[model samples]
Target: MWIHKSRNPNQNFKRGGCMFSIFLWEEKDVQRGLFKMTCFSAVEPKQLGVILKDMQRIKDGYAWFLDGCVFCIQPFQNQSRYSLKGYRIFFNTSIETGMYLYDITLGLLGGQISGIECVIKCPSKKSSDWISGLRSDTSFQMTDPRGLFNKNGCGIIVVNDTVILQMRNRNKLKVYEALKKIDSIREELLSSVEYDLFSCSKEAG
Candidate 1:
């Protein structure tokens, strides 16, 4: 079962309602601690490569992926949230190795987008940095944003661990072609990924 991670209550922020997320996880074994979560809208492929080099935890398998389109929604008007329409694919990896590869691909795609929001490996509970980041950005919402995986009706949860993330019911085949390309070079690019998760607090502190 996936668990939802909650954000600090003290922080304050204001943002629009448009939101969506695409996450890939090993549905067979949640306890193995191997999964990849990502968000997107429109991103430049080239700039993304530069950002990946800076994130060490993702390189080391200690952080989950987070990305989004910073301008998708506006605070003043109630706009319909964006959806990954027309694509349908169950997010089941053939094996644990597929999970690792998908996670890496998700992380890489994250940087291609405008907002590479935040990265928190599962089981992480709290972080002052995350709290401060929420308060610092007026674009980010304090509550859950509407759309897929946001069944709770709240805006994006900064710290998410619950089954809400497992996305057992929904998947996108639009990424299938991308996943195939990623898988082709997977062996040469990702030989072995450590499934261990590092505490967000320990590193944030």
Candidate 2:
């Protein structure tokens, strides 16, 4: 829970909906608790070094390991043409560590990165059934402009024993709130399910 009082007293923050814009604030603005805008530019090696330093500063005991890179592609309409849409860097981290790392990574790389998706492991539950229920439920209807949702019409995807959540919001504050909402939804959905003691014990060990 990263909490910050807004500098604008009149700004009313509304709950629900996914119409958040990119917010790029300077260090001074951060000190003043104000949101600012950022421009999209090519990421340099020095900038990446700075991001690593920043990550080290707040990482605590959490670690974000590089998993792999995915090549993103876009196909042209009614033509045999395709465009390369940059590469997506994948990272592996524990669920507890992922919560904050997701937000921090987005904040640091939002200007250069177009989108971020979190793949949560749901080993105890059937991901297909869970995602189907979420899609059929009216409460989880999230309009996505990126066309990243599955055929079920939600910002969620089921892949084997994992559930992928597409997080499109670039603002760190909005991302934090969304994460809290996601946790609440997860609890509500899994309330009836029995706790996986074996999994807990394995993690603890």
Candidate 3:
């Protein structure tokens, strides 16, 4: 969507009002090691030892919240260029707290709503590369290496059948309760007085 605002002007271009809204949908990386950051990031770790014992579960070199579910984390190395590592989760059920991942590959248990589909390169001390996305139970398609899948498919980066499934299934209220802390940030912009509607009206009168 292009906006035109020129009278033999500066390249005959200007940003429209809606372009500012695009930032709301921008994908932001929420790595685990950067823990005090992004209160908006969500994850349902399958490591009970981390949640129950008040410990941190490290995956792909980052810390994630553990409730109770089973998942697997493997170093993603498929393409000829990048040797990135990622993990996949098989949810028995979903609590729907809205998780964020680089790309989530699901099994028969749970799924994602609208999540980040790209993978991230994490150079941390716990895990290699990390992938995160939204957590919803919609039964999306994951990549089937066997080439025996239906219409609804998901693309997965399988290294070995070494896909270690992990878990942290927990109370739904608790997850949502924690997420409430994350708030939407608002931004403001300014325009010159020459374009001010109020000033223009006053000057014309």
Candidate 4:
């Protein structure tokens, strides 16, 4: 079980009559780290080919579109083994690419999409530390990943190698703001932990 410190309730924001919420997940035992963001969207399974074709048409020589992303439809159980579920359009490699996909996805689908789920992976640090650090630093409620999504449509999850930050809100600005907040928290954690480690080494020397 994960125990978390509470984040300020006032941190939840709403603007232009749209629903906006954010959450951070916390675990009991963990280490510290840095983060890079990746993103994906859930869409109608049938729209997979259409969206892929459109993206290809406007790829504009951006090789990353082909090399750094994935497009696939999910398989579901329906009476047979081949029933298709929804599609997952994923983007990795860089924040710029993820944001670009977010922009065009909105343009193409409008409010039809809930929002993109951004995964912040910390390759050089322990996910447990990141979760613990976020739990202490942010006012976002500490909840299980499922609760985070069921309640606010936005939340964080710590997997084996990464911390996934998911937001389902359709407002682009709010989504960006939430990502920035997470980034800020990550930087603070890195700085504080690094300073502590350095001081410990000096003392040992």
Candidate 4 residue runs with Cα over 4 Å from true position: 1-63, 66-86, 93-97, 109-111, 135-141, 144-154, 170-205
Give Cα-based local distance difference scores for all models. Answer: 0.28, 0.36, 0.22, 0.40
Instruction: Give all candidate RMSDs, comma-separated.
Output: 18.2, 15.8, 23.3, 14.2
Q: Candidate 3, residues 60-158: lDDT per residue as tens digits? A: 222223332212222222222332222332111122322332122222113222221212112221121111111111232334433211112223231
Could you arrange the candidates by lDDT from highest to lowest? 4, 2, 1, 3
TM-score order, best first, reads 4, 2, 1, 3
| TM-score-superior candidate, 2 or 3 | 2
What lDDT score is found at residue 123 in candidate 2? 37
> Which candidate number would show the highest TM-score if scored against the true structure?
4
Which pairs of residues have clashing backbones in candidate 2?
none
Q: Estimate candidate 4's alpha-carbon lDDT, on a 0 to 1 scale.
A: 0.40
- Model 1, residue 30: C-alpha shift (Å): 14
1-205 per-residue lDDT for model 4 (tens digits): 1112243222332221322222111221123322223223334434545654543321111111233232212212122224323223333323454455656653344423334444444435465665565566456566763213221344666565455555554335365555555545545545766776788799999
TM-score of each: 0.21, 0.37, 0.18, 0.42
Report residue 41 deviation for candidate 4 (angstroms).
10
**Model 2 spans with C-alpha error above 4 angstroms:** 1-42, 50-114, 132-138, 141-154, 169-173, 190-205
At residue 181, candidate 2 shows an lDDT of 48
